[model samples]
Target: MNSPLSPIDFEDKRLKIKFKLEKRLQKELQALTKDPPTGVKVDAESIYRNLSEWIVDIDGAPESLYEGEKFKLMFKFGSRYPFDSPQVMFIGENIPLHPHVYSNGHICLSILTDDWSPALSVQSVCLSVVSMLSSCKEKKRPPDNSFYVKTCSKNPKKTRWWYHGK
Candidate 1:
C-alpha cells in the first residue's frame, strides 16, 4: 500500500492549502462535536480555499443581543493561520447591527487579529465572539463602525492586527 503521507499530484498551491485546511477543519469539528459549548449548536460547515473562507452556522447564543437567534458566520483564514489571526464576519441579510460588528458583518475583535496566538483554537474564537455579543447592552452599533468595510482588506500573510488598546 502506498504511504498515506505521499503528496498527491496537484499543481495549485491553493488546492494544497485547501486540503490542509479541510483536514484541520475535520479534526477540529470532530473535537468540537465531541465536546460542544454550552447551549450552542453547529448547523453547517464548509471550506473555500480560493476565497479563503470557512463557513459555520451557530444556533442560539448563551448570552448577549443575539440570544435565541440562529446566525451564520464566515471566517477567512490566512496562509499563516495559527501564527496569525483569521478574519471573521457575519453573513446573511437580517443580522442585527452591533457596535463590534460592521455593516457587512465584519467583526472587530482583539483575539481574531492583534491578540491572536497559536495557543488559540477555533473554539476559542467562537466563544469569544459569543461572549462579546452577550455582553452588549445597547442595540445600536459603534460610532465609526462603517469605516471598517472600506478600510479592511483580506489578510495577505504579513499584515498583523494591532493589539494594544486605544
Candidate 2:
C-alpha cells in the first residue's frame, strides 16, 4: 500500500522547489553580470525587486535595418523556469518593426515555443533575439499582425506561431 503525502511533506517539497528555482535564477544573474552577451543589458533593479520578472534592453546592430534603435524585452519566469521557457516579449514604446514581432510586443520565436530547452540560458536568448534582428534585410510587419495582435492570448507563450528559420 502507498500513503498519501502529508501536509508537512508537501510543504517541505514546495519549499525545496522554490529554493532550487531561486538559486538557479541567481546563478543566471551572476553569469549575465560577469559576462553579458553583446548588446544585452539587464535592468539590475528589476532583478533585485523580483526574480520572476526581468527587463532587458537590447540595441540594434549598427548595420541592420533597425540601426540606432533600442528595444526592451521583458521575461517572465514561472515556477517551472528552466524546465519551461520564460514568457518573453518585446515591451515598451520602441517595439521593433519586424515581421516576427507583433506591435503588441508578442514575438514568434521557436526557442520560446517548440524549441525551448532547459539548457538554454537568458544570455543565449538575448543573443538569439539580436541575431534575428541583425539578419533582417527588410523593414516590415507580418501580414496578419493586426488580426493576431487583437486575438492573441495575454500570455504570448500560449499563442501558436510559425518559424521560418532554423
lDDT of each prediction vs. the true structure? 0.65, 0.89
lDDT of 1 at 13: 62
Off by over 4 Å in 1: 1-23, 43-52, 60-63, 150-166
Report model 2's TM-score to 2 decimal places: 0.95
Q: Pick the candidate with the highest lDDT.
A: 2
lDDT of 2 by residue, 5-87 (tens): 99999999999999998899888888888788778888776697799999889999888888889999999999998999999
Shift in Å, residue 2, candidate 2: 3.1
State TM-scores per candidate.
0.69, 0.95
lDDT string for model 1 (72-130, tens) is 77777677665667777778865556777667676768877667787787777788777
Clashes of each: 3, 0
